[model samples]
Every structure is written in structure tokens, then in C-alpha cells.
Target: MTHDLVIRGGTIVDGTGAAPYDGDVAIDGTEIVAVGNVSSNGKREIDATGHIVTPGFIDGHTHLDAQIAWDPMVTPSTQHGVTTVLLGNCGVTFAPCKPEHREKLAGMMETVEDIPKHAIMSGLSWDWDQYGDYLDYIEKSKPAVNVVGLVGHCAIRYYVMGDRAVDELASDEEIEQMAQLVDNAVKAGAIGFSTSRVEGHRIPDGRPVPGTFSSEEELCRFAEIVRDNGGGLMQTVL
Candidate 1:
């Protein structure tokens, strides 16, 4: 049977963190059907003689959450051969935010991540208010690379506790509410939870990010949500 594409005569670096090998790659539709001496017929072929072919790299730390809405391909990262990217790092994200809190989130991102507030404000569509809706927006956005998200602690706190999240510890009731929000985000396809306890992360108003003030109990409660989910991980900067 004829294949969709064939990449012939190249050094294949099979992403096992091992050494490279000389070979050819065969592709059918979206999958790499073969990676060795591929002698199959194909509709199209790329002459990769003397070139190197490797599985696409993944960027584990990316802040394109806001940028993705406007630049789905994620530009420079994709241009540099990163075919997958993980976003929502340093406890910043745009989901789980109310309309009134949009600027707050933008300001936090600007101050902490050094992403310009005007860029986020002008670029993001801001049509979604829930974590699940944010995922849906990303799916419909059709980014060139695969994108995975982590539920941001700051976003969760801001969503459930509003302004009080910045400097105060959650009460029993608030902790439970925050836990539920994180659980929901994990179930909705977040790969994990992220937070920043670093003193440098603050809002433009000079208040530390809500996650920075979160008690250990609050953090552990959210971590439990990820642990129970069976495949999530925790990423934080303390």
C-alpha cells in the first residue's frame, strides 16, 4: 500500500535520550508508521539525506496561556522545533477568573512573568470564565502544537475568594471551595497544579500573588486533588 509521506536518508534521533542512527522514516496520515529502513512507496517523499530528524521537543515551561488566544502556533517556540508546550506556570493563568477580575489576572501575569499587561489585554479574547471553558477555547483555537495546561493556584484562589485571596489564608469554608475548584480543573484536563511561593511574584498593585500567601494546608489540599487524579504532577517555585 502506498503511504502518505516518506522521509528518506537521515540520521534519526529517536528521543530515548540516546545516540542517533542513520535511517529513514515512513509516515502514513498522522502517525510515523516506521522509522528504519523504510522502502515503502509513498505519495510524497522528502530527501533528508545528510540531515537529522528527531521527535519534536516539548517545552515544559511556557507562558503562552494568554498569547495562545491570539497566536495559536505560539511562534518562537514552535519555530524552534517545540511541537508541544506546557502552560500555566508560576501560578499564573487566565482561567477560573470572573470578568471583573480580568485586569487583576492580567496585572499579576505582567508583574510576575514580565509579560506586558497591554499585550495580554490586547491579545487575549477573554471569552471564558471557567477552567473547562478555557480548555474548550484552546481546543477550538487549533494551535499548531499540542498544548497541555496546569491549573494555576492563583487563578483558583482569585476565582473562589476574590480580592481576599491575595493576603489572607483561606478559612475552612474557603479551603473546601478552593479544593473543589482545583479538583474540577484536574478533571477538566489540567495536567496538574502550579503555584509560586517566591516573593518576587506580585501584582502590579504591590500585593503578593494569592498563591504566595497560601498556607501549607491549602497547598496540600490542592495537591491531594492532583494525587487522586492518578496522572497529575505538582509544579511550583518556592
Candidate 2:
């Protein structure tokens, strides 16, 4: 039977901890119909001899939250066959932001990450102010890769404590508010939460990112939030 396409004569690494083998892959539209000695003729074909064919890669940690606004294809990683990326790593994300606070968050991302502050400020649509809305906006952008987001500590801390997030440990009241943010984010399809404790990841004014100075109690509160929300990942940069 005819198929949509076929890749013939390649070494296949199926990614199930299995050994590689030479094979032909039959395809129907976007779905792989068959593997191994696929005898079906295709409407199109490629001679893949000497090439390696494998399932696309997943990049587990990325900061593509800002970059996705301007570049939906999410290049470089896509060029390297990465089909999915986890964003909002290292506790720096742009959501849960107040309109007046956009510049500060962009500047902080620039200092901690190498992205240009101007680019982040100008390139994004700034359409969302909370974690759920942020995800919804990126969805409207029609990204080329699957995106899994982590709600970040910086945004939650800044949202709850404002500028004091950089230097002050959260008060009991502030921690409670931050807890609600995590719950909101996780319920909105955030796959996890991210935070940082390293001395180096600071904002523009020489202060470490918002979560950097948090007390153990505050950090644990956020973790417990993720845990109680049916349990998810805790990605930390130490």
C-alpha cells in the first residue's frame, strides 16, 4: 500500500534503550506508520543511507519563555532536532508580573541570562500578567516545539513582595500569597517549579534574583505547594 513518505536505509535508534539497526521507516502524514523492513511504496522517498534516524530530542531545561514570543520556531535547539523544551528554568520567568514591573523583570533576565534586555522588552507582546495567561499567550503564538513551563520563584516572590524580594525573606503573609501563586500556576498546566540559590544569578542592580535570599521556610512552602498540587517537579539551580 502507498504511504505519505518513507525514509529508506538508515540506522534507527528507537530510543527505548534498544540497540540500533538498519531499517526503513514508513510514514503517513505526520505519523510513523511502520519501521524496519517497510515494503510499502511512498508518494515521496528519501535515501537515508549513512544517516542516523532517531526520535526527536527533548531539552529539559531552557529559558525560552521570552524568546518564544519573537521566534516561534525556537531555532538552534530545533536545528539540533529538539522537538520539545522545558521553559522557566532557574527561577526567572516573566509572568505573574504587574504592568509597571515589566522593565525590572526584563532587566533581571538580561543580567542573569545573556539575553539582551532591550530585545526582551521590545520583542515580547506583553499580553499576559499571570502564569496561566502567559501559557495561553504562548499557545496563541503557534510555537514549533512542545513547551512545558515551570512556574518560577522570581516572579512569585516579586509578585508577593515587590522590590523587597531581592533582599528580604518573605513574611508569613507573603509566603502564603506566594503559595497561592504556585497553586495557580501548577493548576494552569505548569509542569513544575524552578528556583535558584547560587550567588551569581543576580539582577541588574547587583542583587541576586528574587529567590536567592529566601529563607528555608519560604522555599519549602513553594515546594510543598507543588507537592500538594498532585505532585510535580522541583528544578533548582544551586
Best candidate per lDDT, number? Answer: 2
On residues 13-124, what C-alpha lDDT tens digit does candidate 2 reach at each position?
9999899999999999889989999888999999999999998899998888899878999988899999999999999999888887888889988998889999999998
Cα error, residue 119 of model 2, in Å, equals 0.5
RMSD of 2: 1.2
How much is the lDDT of residue 130 in candidate 2? 86
Q: Tell me each candidate's TM-score.
A: 0.96, 0.96
What local lDDT does model 1 show for residue 105?
Answer: 93
Can you list the residue pairs that collide in candidate 2? none
Which ranges in model 2 have alpha carbons more than 4 Å from their true place? none
lDDT of predicted model 1: 0.89
